[model samples]
Target chain A: MRDKTDKLRRIAIEPVTRVEGHGKVTLLLDEEGRVVQARLHIVEFRGFEKFIQGHPYWELPLLVQRLCGICPVSHHLAAAKAIDQIVGVETLSPAALKLRRLLHFGQVLQSHALHFFHLASPDLLFGYDSEISKRNILGVLHKHPQLALQGVKIRKFGQQIIEAISGKRIHGIAAIPGGMNKALAPSVVSTLQTSIREILPWATQALELAKQLCLADRVHFDGFASLPSRYLSLVAPNGALELYDGKLRIRNSDGSSYIDQFDPCAYDQLINEEARDWSYMKFPFLIAEGPEQGWYRVGPLARVNNCDFIPTPKAEQARQEFLALSGDPLVHGTLAYHWARMIEALHCAEAIDLLLQDSELCSDDLQRQGQKSNEGIGVIEAPRGTLFHHYRIDDQDCVETANLIVSTTSNNHAMNESVRLVADAKLSGREITPELLNLVEVAIRAYDPCLSCATHAVGQMPLKIELHDVRQGLLHWLHKDQRGDFVAA
Target chain B: MSGMKSAFSFDGIQIAFTSGQSIMQAVLDGGGYIPHLCYHPQLSVHGSCRLCMVKVGDRYLSACTTEAQNGMQVENQISELRELRLKLLEMLFAEGNHFCPSCELSGNCQLQALAYELGMTHSRFPLQYPTRKRDGSHATVFLDRDRCINCEICVRASRELDGKNVFSLSGRGSDTALQINSEDGRLGSTDLIATDSSARLCPVGALVFKQGNYAERPNERLYDTHIISETGNRRPAVVSGGYPELGE
Candidate 1:
């Protein structure tokens, strides 16, 4: 099918669905029907930095959470931390810090559980080449009801934690400049404690399921989208796994450390973002490696690989089992993202349990005052990976400039690379079949790219990639309203 | 200003007020709610928002501007006036940007609280989408003209309470807007200190202090927890943390 009269034909996946935000994948093929290039395009740019420039310093946390519905807590906390710097509060009260940490862990927990069970689980539970009609969460419910229930319960548990701390299931404000707005009530703590009894076991069960599925079929899972470059995440001062607060650490693919104990505020010196003409998203890279080789990976895979060890007991036990996958220090298997993500989810659940017990969780010392500063930066390990929020406020206490590197933005280059590898290997010379088109979607879903800003932009076709057996986008990348039952690509 | 007191039936109950008390203020002081945005108890009645439009006999008058006469049957919950006020409220929303979901004053904004009080599900009118100016030039306050309903409560407060006359209106009709009284038309250039007595009484998100934007949980906000009838005409006190500061 000739879309354009040009020599190269484009097989485009307009609006990759089952992710947080909108994204697209265009596979350019030569006259021979050989896939030559693939580009994951974030068609829309929200221009949040420019939108946030004129806002007051305190509005940063409240305003920036409009970025993504899925990971607003990450944005909320990151912006709050940056505001802390603007307010010149270096350390928060223990209660405030604890509340913020609890919020972050909840964000990661629900996000990972949602990605694995709601979005990515169908592909894991059912084979990649399985029937499009039966390869979804519904299908999982029919086949593996217990596992599916665990996934839903796990996601709910995480969201409940968020609500307990932030006041809402989504877009609730927990963090404020220099502290937290509210502390958990004693009743709320008791309620969370009641819910955790059921959730902790479910989280471990979910992790065990992910581990067993991957380990049983190691060969298929390991090599699927196995294009490793480097990894980056936030770790504690003592080199322990930390999600909420930590220093930036990067590890090379070949058992070497690119950087360690890197100050997050000075990330400008360590990282650089390169813009290309094909995509709206900027490819961020390590300043040491440069753009050509510096494109690194973030999120669960990177966090698990880069961190020295997990802090919580159950997650640490699971991490030990996951690390024994190979003799090498790092796990480069792309599909292991699901496994690594569950490990983190387990850690978050356990952490939530421990935090619920802490007496400081209900303390009223929720805020502190400090002298003000002009510039501030906050970094944290979001569910997707490292999220950075930097701002420079004018003397009027309004934001003059805002520099944000969201988790999905950081993984732009890595996703594109993964798409390219999968397309080149599967669709280069072979006939483009229905199952083959889905393989491309499967590869992209592993990274769980948010493509958040595209929906906000005008004139961009917001199509959904029905890879989760939603009864659409099987043969066609973008479906038209044909009178018939289906539209073929 | 007469010393004698008079009674008037508002919505239902006969609320007693001293002579020269506006019907809106009397209903408010009598623990009754007639949805309003611009009418602050401490400020002079401007009757700009038109949200307090009530049926007084055969005429529809803004309750704040209308004086409460003895035995005057004022209809606060009449269908015609309710529908008219609904449209008026919709116009107030359309004429300006009042995106409460993202607004820092979502739960605290008097305009938002009244909308909920009036059961405003959606606006029937098309948004004017006027290109409004925002003044973040102030050290601690933000002047977002987009969310301004042109109520001019700030104008009255600045003139009457603070005696600063720092806020005033500039245009007429469609072009009417609140203008910051400074050399460059910027809030920063004025004598608008963050601690000015009348600084935080704009009744909207327009004149917002730049601290603790989202300090309260949704259910814990003023409007979320209490109806306008229950709270009367007071802006919930704002605290350093996101909780509302009460006069402890």
Candidate 2:
């Protein structure tokens, strides 16, 4: 882990394990003992945009859903928004808008639930050093079946609400340009309302347990408690927090530093991605100062920092508690995820209640009665962060191109920097230990990067240890000596 | 487009539907039951049991291809059409090695039910069970060369539904032989994950489910009379099948 030369050298880790999807991380160390160059590699490329070159614009929503299983709704919404732009379907009635917001809320709630329980909870609950076999949700079930069942039910409730609104569970048919495919029937709305009410108690209990477990080991949040970075997110026209569709804004950790609102179509002017050879995930940075200079973050921490207020009372209260815990609007980036999730759940329940009261929900007319072909873009805040899907269509409106900017891409720069800070702060000028390395890896996973959605990449951690003899002035590679017993490397 | 809101408004009208459901299901659930040839109740829908063609809004469409709609009219009571459908079944019988006296499916076969339903007294088409090959690839299931109807149900079900496009018809028209997709023409060749669901949807005895053999016949089956709206719906029904309930 120590740098020997007086020049910056590249260190890369490929196929990062135990995290969602593929990703790679490459660090460039300079003579000053700091990261001179940091590039996150995002490798998976399905050419989804290329494949949609001739697809009808009407099929964009469903086609884009296949882009990422974790946040299909984000893409579905983005495509619809893009089409709404082309078709001149700008204004959504209050009822339609409420329903759209509810759908977005549902997706964020479920996706965050999945990330916490199925993905990150294992490491938190079972102590990262637990045997591989016992480091999964199923393993948790073996130890505490009732808790596992409760988590599963909460996750299912979110999905069921989605299924009730949209015809299918995975690829919801509800979101359409201008409005939705089908309005919620009275029975469906009632069922969802009842389920949400019933699950609220359980959700509260689960949240309490997560907070307790997270704080049980104070060391979990103690690592690399460095100064905060810039945050970015979307804000509603009325100044209330909006995740589905909003104007983009950037703010610093202090909350006093800010930037002007920008249109998403001008994303090229605001953000850019950097590629490194070691990892498949790319580091996306703000484009204010050139592609590589502007360091910014998206997702939970960014959302909290960028927005002035949340719509739901309970969520707003949670935001207050979050700021209390961290003192800064960025709110201790590590714990920002917990705040993001609670806010999403509260917003989801409140939005669902609002949508149910709308008269348009009871209407039988789900479709517009006719199909119109036009390009569309839908942008929404996924659980991980901001998501955008941009589509182009030809005459007769077949899809000409479908480009997507996943939530994880927005946080790429910050995540890489997080890893570098943890490595430098925790292991600088000191001997490297397996415990320290694992902690460094944990710091990166805290952001919950979805590299697969971005570049179809996976992350790999390759630890290189070199022993230097002060008398010798040179270090020897320990890899060859440990080879036969070094497992699979 | 119609303002009809009553549940029974379209009763006895035989409305044509052609989007999602199979023909046999449309006939049985749509209130008019058409005698089927080579169709099974438990397996996936197979149009090879061609006895369910009813005149759609205008053109004749296989009931299986049409998803039922609200008001489009339909009819299957034409005598000439009934006679034509029956005649085809008889032709299929005479051309194959069908011996009811020894056949195990004689009492439950869809072809047999159609014969009784249509009152077929004799087979007019000449008999010709051509010399063909039959290889028993798996230990449990046996393939009978004399029984295949060249219906392409097994082929289509395997390819489209299962995503394993294995089976294909080699020869054209009457000379078609069901070839297991391999250059060597051996069933053992290729990446045929036997667990591939294509064979599970086989209508006739061509690809029998190893577990549900000698199960209930159409007359005693509940799903036969009622449409299976959901795949895993397990409503209590006449348990004439040798196999026990799946979840049990």
DockQ of each: 0.59, 0.02
Q: On residues B90-161, what C-alpha lDDT tens digit does candidate 1 reach at each position?
A: 888888877676677777667777777778998999988765878877767788888888777788878887
Question: What number of clashing residue pairs does each candidate have, in the order they appear?
Answer: 4, 48
Q: Candidate 1 lDDT (Cα, whole model)?
A: 0.77
True contacts kept of each: 0.62, 0.00
Q: For model 1 chain A, where is the 10-residue window of minimal lDDT?
A: A464-473
Listed per candidate, the RMSD to the true structure in angstroms reads 4.8, 17.4
Which regions of candidate 2 are displaced past 4 Å?
A1-20, A26-40, A142-146, A213-222, A225-227, A273-282, A357-359, A365-375, A426-437, A453-489, B1-248
> Tens digits of per-residue lDDT for model 1 on A1-489?
233312121244233333344555666555455455667766565778897776667877878887878788999999989888888899999999998888888888898888888777777777777766677677888998888888888888889878888888888878877999888999988998899888999998889888877877877777777876789999998888988888988989975888989999999999989989756678998887789888899989898888878989899888877878742667887778889999999999999999889999999999888988899999988898899999998766778898999888888887777777777777633345555555666676778635542221111223322221122112334332212112444
Comparing only chain B with the true structure, the TM-scores of all models are 0.91, 0.66
Q: What TM-score would chain B of candidate 1 score versus the native chain B?
A: 0.91
Best by TM-score: 1
TM-score of 1: 0.90
Instruction: Report the C-alpha displacement of residue B194, candidate 1, in angstroms.
Output: 5.0
Docking class of 1: medium
